[model samples]
Target: MKKIITLFAVVVGLFAFSSCTTTDDNFQEDFDTYPYAFEIKNVDLGRVADNEYNLRSTFQFEINDNLRDDETVLIYRLTSTINSNTPVWQLIPRTIYFNNGDLVDYFFDFSKVDFFITARANFNLLNRREYIDDQTFRIVLIPSDLAATMDTNNYLEVMNTLKLSENQVKKVKL
Candidate 1:
């Protein structure tokens, strides 16, 4: 009876350890880093106070969410097909680092957008009754680890065509 009981205990311990061991199948899921995320707080466009020379409106992007890792944030100005008559807002690279603390603020000066688009928009507003071209933009947070290995060209090529995960897509409209 003693021998049988000792053997049973040993068998149970072995099974427990084996179940917890890291294996190839579960390695990725267990050890992969969590994706970075950003919750855009205030998405508003208005004039900057105390700056008379700056006639163009200021677009303020306030992100109040905490991130797990430093990420390269991609901001894109959607094409006309996606958001009709909207000006191409931006095409630039901005990185959000962990050291930025609980909140990060990024600003885009609308004054830099193409003159033609702004001119046409202003003209339409004056000529056509309450004609304002509503625009939408997209922000994608790419984790540094995945971004380092990503095929950027391919990703940009299929940006609109492919279905991106909800966790990665953030939208701001004007």
Candidate 2:
């Protein structure tokens, strides 16, 4: 009986000691700075078809070297406004990983036509200015009720914008 009690106490002590040892390798600190810089790199508006449209865009953001060590999370709100003078704006909110390079997309009914694409990126609870991209062409329904044709120029334009912003952010190191 004495031996068993001693062994149980030794096991409990060992368990407590092991639990106190923590590794910080995977720990990411929170961001503590403000005025983070971000840009919408690319905006791709898919062709409208049968009164429906598909849109996707990519945003690239760079944290100042001072804040780079901190793990930053990015939240975005996308809105579609007509004529740039509307007081009521349609809102779409999405959360994205800052370190992960992913493109965000949305599908909407094209019948409710719009003229501008406004994307706002929120970083670490700080609200950044809304970056507005104007749509040069109007979405028209195909007589055949087919999807709108994909234009090479539009796709290339969006790709170029994303590439440029990503390149700029990649240059930062801390």
The model with the greatest TM-score is 1
The superposed Cα distance between candidate 2 and the true structure at residue 131, in angstroms, equals 16
Best by lDDT: 1
Model 1: per-residue lDDT, tens digit, 1-174?
999999999999999766643343222221123222222323332323211111132233333232333545454433244355333334322222234232212333222221111112212122322112233345444544555555543435324322244455443233
Task: Give the C-alpha miss distance for residue 117 in model 2, angstroms.
Answer: 16
**What residue pairs are clashing in model 2?**
41-162
Give candidate 1 misplaced runs (Cα > 4 Å).
1-44, 49-66, 82-90, 93-133, 150-174
lDDT of each: 0.35, 0.30
Which tens-of-lDDT digit does each residue in 41-77 have in candidate 2?
A: 2344343432223344322222233333222222222
Please give the distance, in angstroms, between residue 28's alpha carbon in candidate 1 and its true position after superposition: 6.5
TM-score of each: 0.33, 0.20
Please give me the total number of clashing residue pairs in predicted model 1.
Answer: 0
